[model samples]
Target: EAAIGIDDSFYRVGGDSISAIRLLVLCREAGFELRISDLNNTSTIRSQAARALSDDVISAPGTTTQYAPFDSFDEETVQRLKDNVVPGIGLSWDSISDVAPATPLQRGLISETLRSDGGDAYVTWKITSFGSDMDAERLRRSLVQLVGSRSIMRTRFALDPILGVVQVVLKEQVGEELVPAVEYCTSASEVKARATAVSQDQRWGRPQTSPLHIQIISAQGEATSMVWFSHHALHDGWSFSVMEQEWRQLYDADGEKPISTIGVDVPFTNVSRYLAGRDNEDDLNFWKTYLADAEPVRLASGSTSGPPPPDANAQKTITHTTKCDLSSVARACAVPPSTVFLFALATALGLFADSDDISFGLILSGRTLPVDDIARVIGPCINTAICRVRLQQTQSAATALQQLQADLDEINERG
Candidate 1:
C-alpha cells in the first residue's frame, strides 16, 4: 500500500535474491549496470546508482557462448542419447543435434502436468511493456535471437526409457520456428488478453511440443507489449531476468549482426547436466535426519483419511495488514527483515495447525550450485526444500527468532 522511493531499501520492502536479479536487469536496461551483490549489500536505489555508475563505470557484460552442442559429453555419448531419445518422440535422428538431462524440477512439473492432463499449473505468461524504440521487424528479429540463444526455448522434453526425462534439443535449422511470428492488435490491452488466451489454451499441454509462445503486439506499427507464454519448466524468475537482459541487447548491443551469431555463455542444458550429475548423498541424508521428527502443518479440514484430495481448480488471493513495523522487529532480533518474515510465516502456520512443530515447503534458487557464473546462469534452476521449525513453550520470542535465523543461515550455506 506504500510507494517505494529511490532511497527505500529493497529487502525492507519485501525483495529477495530472485527479485534482486530482476531489479538489476531493469537498472541495466535503464543505462545503469549493477551486480547482484550490490543489492545484497545496500539495496537502496540511490546508493546503488552512485556506486555502480561512478565515472561511467558500467562493467562490461561477459561474452555469450556460441552454438556448441553438448560439450559435457563425448560425441559418441551425445549421439547415443539423441538416438535413444528420438524414437520416444516424432523427431528423426538427423534432426536431433544433442541431448541433455532435464532439470529435476522441470521433470517433476512435466510429470504432474501429464498426470493432471489439463490445468493452468505449468503454463505461465510474462508481459513486458516496450515503447516504439525498436521497429516491428527489428523486434521480431530480437524474438528470433532470443529463441536461438537459449536451447530450452527451442527444445522438447521427452521421457526416455533409459535416461528418464531428457531434453531433446533440435538442430538449429529445425528449431527455427520455435518463436511464433509477431501478431498485431489495435490496442495493447487486446494483445495482452490474446496472449492470456493463448496461455490458457490446452492445445500445447503435452511437453513434447515447443513450450514457448510469443506475441509482439504492435498498434499502428508501434510496438506496445510483449507476451511470453512458456511452460513453467522452461523458465523461472531468474530466467526472466536473464532473458530480458539478452533480449534488450539483441537490438542494442548486437544490432548489426545476425541473431544466430549470438549464444548464451551457460545454456540451460549445460546447467541441467551439472545439476543432474551432482552427488546428493549428503543432502539426502541431511534432509532425512532434519525432517525425521517434523510434523507437517496442514489445514485441519476434518476428513484426513482417504487419498490426498485433488488440487482445487479455483484460485484466490488473500491480503492482510499485520500492523507491525517489521524493520524494528528485525533490528531487535539482529536479523534481516526476510528472516523476520520467515519466522512470522512459521508462527502463522503453527497457529493455524494448532501445533508447535511445523514443516513447510520452501523454494530455493539452486543458484548456489558450485557452477561458475551461477548468479547469471539461466533456466528453472530451483529446488523445493522442507523448512522445519519447533517452537518450544519455554523459549522467548527473541530466542525463537535467533534459532530460525541460525537454521536459515545453515541452509543458505549448504545450498
Candidate 2:
C-alpha cells in the first residue's frame, strides 16, 4: 500500500524508484497525470497532486500515429516476412501493422526459449470472476476491441536467418485468436482440469503465438471466470493495470454489442524505437568497465549465486526457511529493510566465498527513456545491470549499510 498524506515519505511507506513508476500509472488512470520528476522531488500526495495535470488537461492521445517501419533488418528478409512468413503464422498481409526490431530483453527471452525447449518461465496467469449478469458476448467483443487497439497484444517474435530477431505486428485479431470458446463446467474437478490445461498450454513458450490469451468459463450456480495468462512481453503488471481499467469500463458500458470505439495510449513501437536510439557504444562501454573486474559469484554453500561448479550439481540437499522482521534493525541502521537484507546477504556471501570483492546484478526497471508516458508504456521494460561491492570485513553493520546505500545511490544517479 502507498503512503497517504501531505508529507509522507514514499520510501518509508514501501515505495521505491521502480514502483513509483507503477504508482504514476495508477495516479494517471484516476484522471490526474502524475509526473515522475515531481515525485522524485517531493514524494507527498499534496505536493505531487498539486503538480499533477487535471483531467481537463490530460488528453488520451489514442494510438493512431502510424509509426515508421524500423529499418534495421534486411529489406529482402523483411519482404519475405511480409510475403510468406506472415501467412504461415496465420496472419493476413492486410492485418500486418508494423514490423520492428525486438527489444533486447525480448531477443534474450526468445532465444532462451528456443535454446531451452518449451521454457515458460515468464508466463503469468490472472483470473477474474463475474457474477451471473456477465454478458459473455459483450466481454468477448470488448476483448477483441482491446487486442485490436494495442500494439503489444499483436506482437509476435520471429527469428531471422541474417536479419536477427524481429517482432511482427498484426493490425487486429478477431474472434478465437484471443477470446476462445466458453467452457461450461458443472463440477469442481472440471475447473481443476481446466486450470491445469491453462498452465501447460503450448503457446506460452512459442514465439509465434500472440503475447496474450484469454478464456472464459461458466460453472453451474457460480460466477463466470475469465482467465488471462500472457508472456511477460505483453502484460507487465503496469500495462495490465491500465488495460484492466479500460476493459472493465468497456464491459460495463455496452451489453451484447461490439465495442468499436476504443481509447489508446502511445504505441509500444514508439517506445521501442526510442530505446533503440539509445543503444549506443557509450552505454555498452560504461557497463563493460563497470563490471570489468567482477567475476561470477560462487556461494561457499549456496547455489543461487551462479551455476554451481561442474562438480556441485546434484551433490546434496539443504532446505531451511526462517523469517524475521528487520524493521527495528533497519531503523537502527538508518536504512530500509531491503537494504538491510542486502547487507546481510553480502556478509553471508563474503564469509562463504572468502573474497573481499563481490559483484552482483542490480535490475533496473528500464523505463528511463525520455518518451511520452514511458512509465506507463510497458513492453518488456526490464534490465539487469551489475553492482560491484568491496566488503570492509571489519566494519560495523551500520557503517556497511551506509556505504552500500551510497554506492547504490551512485549507481542510480549515474547508471
Residue 160 of model 2 has an lDDT of 62
Global Cα lDDT for candidate 2: 0.64
Local distance difference test, per candidate? 0.67, 0.64
Best model per lDDT? 1
* Candidate 2 lDDT, 1-415, residue by residue in tens: 4436777655545555566566656555554554444443235666555555343435454322335764645678678877776676677778777777777777777777667645665667777767767766677767776776677876777666655677787766553577777778785456556756775666653567656778877665555677787776665566777678667767776643333434454567776665565546776666676667776677655444666587645567679987866876654554556667777777667777777677776776656544456665647666666677678959887778767765665454334
Residue pairs clashing in model 2 are: none
Candidate 1 TM-score to native = 0.71
Q: Looking at model 1, which ten-residue stretch has the lowest summed lDDT?
A: 59-68
Any idea what lDDT model 1 has? 0.67
Colliding pairs, model 1: none
